[model samples]
Target chain A: MLRALRNHHGEPSVRRPLFSPVNLAKAIGALTVAILAGVLLSGGTFAYMNSTVALPSATIKAGSAALTTTGTPLVLTGLYPGQTQSAAFTINNTGIVPLVLNVSGVAAPAADANSLSAALTIRVDVTTAAAGCSILPGTAGWQGTFAATLPTANAPVSLNSTLAAGATATLCLSASLPPSAPSTVQGGTTKSFSVTIGGVQS
Target chain B: MTRSRILSSARSRIGVAVGLVAFLVLVGSGTAQATWTTLSSAQPATASATTASVLLSDISALNTTYNYTGTTSPLVIAPATLQNTGGAPLTYTLTETNTNATLAAKIAVWIWLQVSGSCGTTTVGTAGTLAAIPALPAGATSGTAGQSTVVCIATQLTGTILASSGSTLTANFTLTGKVGANWQGTDPSSITQSVFQAADVTNITCSTSGHGSNTTATVSWSLPAGATGASIYVGSTLVLPDTSTVSFTATKANVGSATSITIKANYASGVQSAGVVQALDSANGSGCG
Candidate 1:
């Protein structure tokens, strides 16, 4: 009687859920997929030839040098004795090569023999600005006075610097007829002034 | 979300960021293949109120025969001429404003004084005088009247300056000769010269002998002293040469009984001298007989 009691009470009872075909199939499919992936990754049949190949060498080339100017041409009107006005323009290096810029100014002849160009003192102030005709973004680079002459242009003065590929700089010009003006420019308009900025490889 | 799931999402985002960085690196490497080209443009600005104006009258493109026999080491051409029409006596300064930098590096522009007379077929100058610009020795002074001055240039190439094969190099020059005196307005004269850089070739002869279906032809020519190499073209086909003369076996079918060919010489710095035309007579084939 004691042995029957020990066998019936002391034995741990095993509770099994009802086995379903769907669960069995799902588990089997998951295990099969895992095994197939493992075989494909590390146990697949693959072969490679024990030979070498030589690829053709590549050549490198340099890019072009290009420059462009933005903003309207500098214009100043309503002339009087000792009147000073300032205008600004932007120069952009659009090419791939670095270039040294050369700037020159030319004064065109006015209708009167003694136009404002002869009577006026012109100064060009160049600074690297955030944008055209805006405040300075960097250090001031170049500043010079335009020579007094018409038909004859100013000497080419280097920007004293270089513009790297894809860089921009701004030029500001201020013109004034000094208070000590000769009576010659009283009622005449100054001829248009032409300025050329040229670039050469540095 | 669980820590593991969050960590897994982070790793996925890192992988995506790495992929994007790799793509950008590839694109940056592709930009290295771009070639450097040159560009030049101009705009007009006016300055009125004039007295006597000094105008940039001409940028004449001139030529010179590669006189190998001449005393000058290299030939010179006066491609630009400047005249001072203004009343003031002015001192002239030249600035090579714009040019193809690669081409500019190969050539040199100078202020040349006419050896007193004309540089025509006879070469009247006793000896050629070359002066580098920026500092004109006898400063290129304009006469009181509108006297014209030749802006002579002696161009040098990495090799010989020869014929039409050389690149058409456009050199822009600006002359600023102003009087320092009071009330003297400085006038700027500017011009652009397209220098062809061609050398002259003379006395080229060609001949062929042999009665076979194919004949060997001989061609010989003379070039200036500075000539580096020459090329001979028979009809449309070019016969390359390392020396001054070249001989080639010509088939009757390829080069007719007689063919007209042009021979051009190569100068230092890739300047190609002018080409000379010569006639080549092939041997009479057996069929012709």
Candidate 2:
């Protein structure tokens, strides 16, 4: 291995026309690359050549990207108490780091969002998660509905994957006046709730 | 012999040139290198009612009120500790509507009733400001719990609602946030005043003025079935209360329209008038004679 490296180290001791710029240049270039690679693999964050070779490592850990919305989670409103109404959901992250959220896991009705998800009983379906993670409020990605009653106890928070420090994520939520299904929903109604999003990364 | 040798030399030189050229480019690339990585997470709403965080509605800067509350329980419903929208003085208006518009006629309305807290010998309403809990740990007081929207609502004395007014009353809601204050948003209220129905009522009258000897007089009145009790007055002279219409009787010897009358309920003269007189007639018995 030592002898082989020597064979190609720096300029190869090739006897040829002394004026062959291409050949000489090639040899010099190869040597420079080999040496530079050795330096880079050692964790060179910058390419300052002779600068501080301080090999340092950094890690990004974001707090949970939490979300909050404007207005009551459950509203006792409609043409009547038992009247059908549409609603919207929003997501936000208040963290100092960026996070990726998988809306796939969020169950909701099909259509609108790139994926599908279903409604949860007595819940908005916005569950909590660790820092730097989140999911869009409803399925079909942006907006959807509970397709059921909205209770006051449950607190849904779709966390962003990585909450960039102090960054935020927002998703607008609107009431889903179901076009069809169930005896309670009345199929479809013009009644709707103004959906809003609020949140922060921890 | 010369051609062959020259070709061999040329091939070796080209090979070295190619390799060296590749190496040079690789080394130069290091001078300006950058990398980026993205991160993510997963979340979805299985249900609803995510956060109960108290959002301070009308934060009065000019009003500069130290505190505020929206219910009789005096539970601070806004700007909670470590939990606030962090805005300038805001406006919060509470509006009330008669949900039972059909039954709202003749109903009274009380405007501007708010939940207040105690600031040492102070009766809430306009004095004490409120927090979730004046105590530590930010505990919730009575007003914070319960779906009883009653305490949070205000009403006026029983007023005569006019059926001619369309049986419905709507309050336009608005909020003026105090300027130069810690808050700048308004918590506008879209309150609904649901109305409960009361049974229909009819006036009871004595058909006859006076009764002759052995004369049989018929007395009748109209009312919704739920008549718990009623009363009758015998001219300013006396009053009698009857629980059931079937057993009510007034068999006085002398009865006439000129006889004064007064009605009493639970001992006191209920809404009706006193000194009411009844007519005495021969065809029928006097009013309650």
The lDDT per prediction is 0.51, 0.32
Measured with DockQ on alpha carbons, how good is candidate 1?
0.07
Q: Estimate each model's TM-score.
A: 0.28, 0.26
> B108-177, model 2: which lDDT tens digit per residue?
3222223343122222233211111011111222122111111222222133211221233343333322
Candidate 1 Cα errors over 4 Å, as ranges: A1-62, A104-107, A110-114, A130-155, B1-40, B43-289
lDDT of 1 by residue, A1-202 (tens): 3232233668755432332345445555555555555545664476675777898998888567777876356665434444455567767889877877766444444444555666665554556565444443243333333443322223555656677779976766555555455545544566655555656677
Please give the clash total of every predicted structure, in order.
45, 101
Q: How many backbone clashes does candidate 1 have?
A: 45
lDDT of 1 at A81: 42
lDDT of 1 at B213: 63
For model 2, the local distance difference test gives: 0.32
- Best-fitting candidate, scored by DockQ: 1
Residue A59 Cα positional deviation in candidate 1, in Å, after optimal superposition: 6.9
